[model samples]
Target: MPVVLSLNVARKTIPVDYARAGATGIDKRPVDGPLRVSPTEAKGTAGSGVAGDSIGDWTVHGGEYQAVYGYAREDLDWWQSELDVPLSNGQFGENLTTQGIDHTTALVGEHWRIGSALLEVTGPRIPCRTFAEFLGQRGWVKRFTQQARPGAYFRVLEEGLIGPGDEISVVHRPGHDVTVELCFRALTTEAALLPRLLAAGDSVPPEVVELVHKRSVVELDS
Candidate 1:
C-alpha cells in the first residue's frame, strides 16, 4: 500500500536567483500531522492547496490544477545514487513525499484518497530554471526532462486534512493509457506523442490540448 512518507510545507520564501519573484518556496520542510487541503481562493494569485505551504511564484506555480505536488521516495533514492548526494523528503519542492507508488505511471485524472481528502491527478511537474538552480545542477532542466520521471501534480477534489503516514488509496483511475510520464514526454521531448494525449480527454491540461489541436491543424495543412 502507498503511504505518505512526509508531509512537507514551506514555512517561508527564500531568495533565489532563478525565479522571477526573486524568492522561492522550494525549501520545504517536513511537518507533523493534519495539514488542510483545499482549492486556492484564486488561480495565479493565491498559493498552494495545503494550508501553510507558501508559493512564492503564484504566476505559474500554484493554481487549481497544480494545487499539490507529489514526488516518489523511490525516485529520490535513485537521484541520490545517481548524483552521489543525500537527498531528503521535500527536496524537490513536493508537498507530499510518497512511498510505494509509481507516480510517473499513474493515469491522468486518477483519484487518490489520502486521509479525508480526495485528490485527482492533474498533470506532471515541468522542470523549470528555479528547479535547476535549487538543485545547483548543471543542465538540470534538460536532464530532468530526458529522465521523464517528472512526478505528479494534483487538484483538490474533496477538501480535508492529510498527514504523514496517511495511507494513499487509489479510489479511481481514468480509462486511458495516458500516464503522467506519457504526458510529460508529449509536452517536452516528444511532440509526436501529442496526438495520443487526446485519448485522455479533458483530464489533460487545457494548454496541452490546445497545443495538440494546433499541431493537428499544421499537419493537415502540410
Candidate 2:
C-alpha cells in the first residue's frame, strides 16, 4: 500500500524577496497527528485536509480541481541526487509527501482512499513562478519541465481525517490512457496529444480542456 510519509501545512507568512515573494501561500510545513481532509468550499482557500495549509494564490492554486497536491517520496529522492540539495517533506509545498506510489503513471481519474477520505486524481501540477522562487533554483522552470515529473493534484470526494502513515491505495482507475505524466506532456511538450486529453473528461479540468482545444485549433490553422 502507498502511504503518506508526511502531512504538511504552512502558516501565511510574510513574503521573501523573490519572484514569488508577493505570493501568499507557497510555504508549507510538515504536520503530525490527524488532519482533516475535505474539498475546498471556494477558490483560494485552504481545502479540507490539514487545516492551515494555505495556498498563496487561490485563483491559480486552490480549487476543487486542485484541492490537495501529492508528491511521491521517490521523486523527491531522485531530485535530491540531481540537485545535490537537502530536500524535505513539504519542500515542494505538497500537502502529502507520499511513498510507494508511481505518481508518474497515475491515471487522471484514478481514486485513492487514504484514511476516511476518498480522493480523485485530477491532473498534473503545473510548475509556476511561485514554485520556482520557492526553490530559488536557476532555470528552474525549464529544468522542472524537462524532468516531466510534476506531481499530481487531487480533488477530495469524501471528507475525513488523514495523517502520516495512513495507508493509501488505488480504489478506482478510469479506463483511459491519460496518465498524469502523459497529461503533462500533452499540455507542455506534446501539443499533438491535446486531443487525447479529451478522453479524460472531468479528470482534466474544463479550463484545461478549453485551453487544449484552443491550442489544437491554432495548430491546425497554422
Candidate 3:
C-alpha cells in the first residue's frame, strides 16, 4: 500500500548555475493539495503535469513522458544515511515523494492509481548537472549514475486530482522485465545491456529505443 508521503510543487523558479535557463524549479516544497494532473499541452513546450508545479527547463525536463516524477521515501532515507544529510520531502525535485514502494524496481509501463489519477511509468530520471548542483555534491552525477537508483518518471494516463496521503495502487503492469533500474543502467553506465531493453517494447521512451538501435549498429560495425 504505497502512499504519497508528500505532494510537492514548485510555485516559482529559483536561480541556479547548472541549467541553461539560469533558474530552476527543482526546489520543490510540499503543498496542501488536491492538485489537478493533466498531460502537458505539448512536448518540450509545456511545463509540469501537476497544475502548480513549475518546470524551469522545458526542453529537457517536462514533456508527455516526464510529466510527473516519483521518488520513494525509502530511497531518500538511504541517501540521507549515505550522505549524513537531512533530506525533506521534495528534496530531489520529485512531484511525489512516496512511501511503501520501491520505485527503483518498478517496471516500466506499470500503472499506478493515485487518488483519482492514473499514471503510467514511462522512464527513469536521468541525473543531470542541475540535480547535482541542487544537491551541492561533488561528482554527484557520476555517483548517482553508478548507484542506479534513479527514480521513475510517469505520464498522466487518466487526468484527475492527486494529493498527499493518497494511497498509490498498482493497477497494471506490462509484461516485461525492464525495471527502472535496468533502464537507467542501459541508458547510462551499461551499454552492453541495451539489447536487453528490446523486450520492453514501446513502454520505454522512444529516445531509448533509438539509442539501442544506434548502438547495435555501431557494435556490429566494430
TM-scores across all candidates? 0.95, 0.92, 0.95
Highest-scoring model, TM-score: 3
Whole-model lDDT, model 3: 0.90
At residue 175, what lDDT does model 2 achieve? 91
lDDT against the true structure, each candidate: 0.91, 0.83, 0.90
> What is the C-alpha lDDT profile of model 2 across 123-204, one tens digit per residue?
8988877778788898888899999999998988888888999999899999999999999988788878888888988778
**Clash pairs, model 3 backbone:** none
Better of 1 and 3 by lDDT: 1
True-structure lDDT of candidate 1: 0.91
Residue 211's C-alpha lDDT in candidate 1? Answer: 92
Clashes of 2: 8
State the displacement of the C-alpha of residue 125, model 2, in Å, after optimal TM-score superposition: 1.0
Clashing pairs in 1: none
Clashes of each: 0, 8, 0
Q: Write the per-residue lDDT of candidate 3 for residues 1-222, one digit (tens) a residue.
A: 789999999999998777998999999999999899997654577889999889898888888889999999999999999999999999999999999998889998899999999999988999999999899999999998888889999989899999999999998988889899988888888889988888877667677788889998998899
lDDT of 2: 0.83
